[model samples]
Target: MAPSSNLLNTQIDDIVKTVLEDATGDVYMVNPSRDAIEDFVSVATADDDDLPTVHMLADERTLKDVMDDFIVASNAADLIDAGRLELRTIEEAPENSLLVTDDAVVAIVHAADRVGGLVADDEEFVSATVETYAGRWDDAEPFSLRTPPITRVRNTLSEEISPEAEDDFTTILGSLETARGDGDGLDEVTISLLFAARNEALLYDISKWGEDVGIASKATFSRTKTKLEDMGLIDTEKVPIDVGRPRLRLKIGDERLADADNGQLATVAQSMLN
Candidate 1:
């Protein structure tokens, strides 16, 4: 890619890749979109040999958007834990987005139809951009993410519980990514209940596992289970226990749910929810 003072009509991911490829040291990103950050992390994580440290300053809203999605949040957390990424938040973000590196400075351009960027390699421009954003990076507040690494969650679920549950959990995550809205998407707890229902697992066992893994509290899982039951998506049957109350075994309630495969379960449940 040639150095351009003017915006080029190209994909944001491509521009990010080009700029990152030329970077000599650490990079600074100013107010990148969720998609841009995803692209950046994808490139950074893919390259095992040279993982340059990335300093990101984004708005609180954009950070929340990233954190709300299980897959994105978990991936970002993994990078942070590995010291490959540093994420921070600001109260208000500047109008333009930028990626500053020793090699060049790329200004992210948002068009009505697509995203683009302007790459500048002039010494003075690159130096000034770096100085300004580096200062902002120092002043910004660091973001603390609570989501666990996805690899850990997947491995633990498969090891501690059943592999079938882990597979269903992954399928539901894929579905939720393309789902319409926040309310329309099934959350972590709901997905856990769906997994338990699919496997006919005991509620106490799944909820306890969830709490232990830092996914959610047992009470939270119970509430979601009740909500799912009321929505006719799942049914619970009592199993006799030697001690106090009987344990509940989860099962698919609706005929549609029972018939749907793991891939279609989230879609069917979302339709029912709507």
Candidate 2:
């Protein structure tokens, strides 16, 4: 899509790129919806080194919605730590969504099912909009995201475990955008089990590592493991440890999963899941 199109044919990504292309300094995004935030963040972070800093002010509910998606939340946290993005939470829902730069303002328009943008460069309108949102940004409380950066997760997993496991992790993440609770896709726990089965890793080790890295709880991992096993996507063997209970080692239970590569594991698993 052309960045110049600001009519009904334009989407959020087009507007974001158009505004960022001419941005002089920091850009302020006011009250973008969850979908708008996803589009903006994906575009901004794709080549963040050249883009100006972005300050986003959204309501608590929107912030929470972004945080619930693992991919966006992790990427946003990475950008926040790198000083490329800033986030703040407002109390009430906003009436308008806007992208404000020093000299121009892009008003995001939502009509029925279509979305577009209107760029305004008039000094009076730009100044008023910037000033109003600048005050709101100053007063809004900072929103914190607890999800670890995906880069760190991948790096630490490679260092702490086998490279094969990390490879599977990366491939699984690449296969989907969100990690959990979208209803149409597999969740993090399911992904973890599939990767563990791919590597024939001990359930205790994978679950422990997952918990330590804040992916999910061990009990949740156990439940997910049982569910996958029942679905025939994963099978486990009792590994006799000279300790409390014999730990289970995960393996691919079906020929389809066993033959699929790391990149295809998530797709194969999702098909089985459905």
Candidate 3:
């Protein structure tokens, strides 16, 4: 296919912007296929550029993609080594090519300003460092992954948060991302009090979740329970064993939220700090 001069120019502009004030040496740009990475790494260091560098990566999370990417990179190793490609240039770039630096995030916000991406949408898990690389299309579904809203705290939670709780929230999200559904996740008071109220997913008349995980009040607990209900992650009518009245029993959603989570995980993994 003929290169779309317009599209190519725009992408080049974006990539160049990524090489801000860092000490100039060599830089490498990579897309998320192992074959592309290997191919790039092979000829990459020798290619004419303002910088001499090798960027190596192919995001094949699945066994098959991994194998394919590895094959090409390995085959081309001789080419890369001969070029004296700077190891720094060869830093791993996941196929997503996501780079999440404060600068990158700001750039994304600025470019997407027209799209109303301005809303406070950073996940607790996403650092100020922000970068995005193209996601590989799945051979099966041909879909790209994304960081979902639930994982990120709205700007409302950004302020007055203790560093400790912030750390707490971040850790929980990390676990939640990998913890497979028992097909049976629970929204206990601990979840309702901290993440819900703090992240503004739920607004209780009173939110002291950061202080107590057990949750001492019934009235306030009920309010947040309803909030989770609105989100559809929990059922309000379960549990006859311990309560005279129907108590809100927390539960995970079937697939929608889970899919959302996976998307976000992809973004986070891709955006990891090198």
Q: Largest lDDT belongs to which candidate?
A: 2
> Across residues 1-274, which tens digit of lDDT does each residue of candidate 3 receive?
1111212223322333333222133333333333333334334333444433433222335313332232222323333434433222213443243323222221111233221111122544233222222221111122121112221232223444444445445554444422211222222333434333333332322244322322235655767556555655444234454636543334433234334343243233222211
Kindly give the stretch of ten consecutive residues in candidate 1 with the minimal lDDT sum.
175-184
lDDT of 2 by residue, 21-140 (tens): 878878898889888899987887797457878899888887897788887887887788788789898776468788888888888988887787877777898788788888888998
Question: Which segments of candidate 1 are over 4 A away from where they belong?
Answer: 1-7, 41-50, 178-181
Candidate 2 overall Cα lDDT vs. reference? 0.82
Compose the digit string of candidate 1's lDDT tens values, residues 118-230.
77888888888788888888888988888787777788889878998899888877776632237757777788888889999999999988898777899999998999999
Candidate 2 lDDT trough over 10 residues, lowest sum: 1-10
TM-score per model over all chains? 0.89, 0.89, 0.22
Separately for all candidates shown, the number of backbone clashes (residues 3 or more apart, or on different chains) is 0, 0, 16
Displacement of residue 16 (Cα, Å) in model 2 is 0.9
Which pairs clash (backbone N, Cα, C closer than 3 Å) in model 1? none
Instruction: Give RMSD (Å) of candidate 1 vs. truth.
Output: 2.6
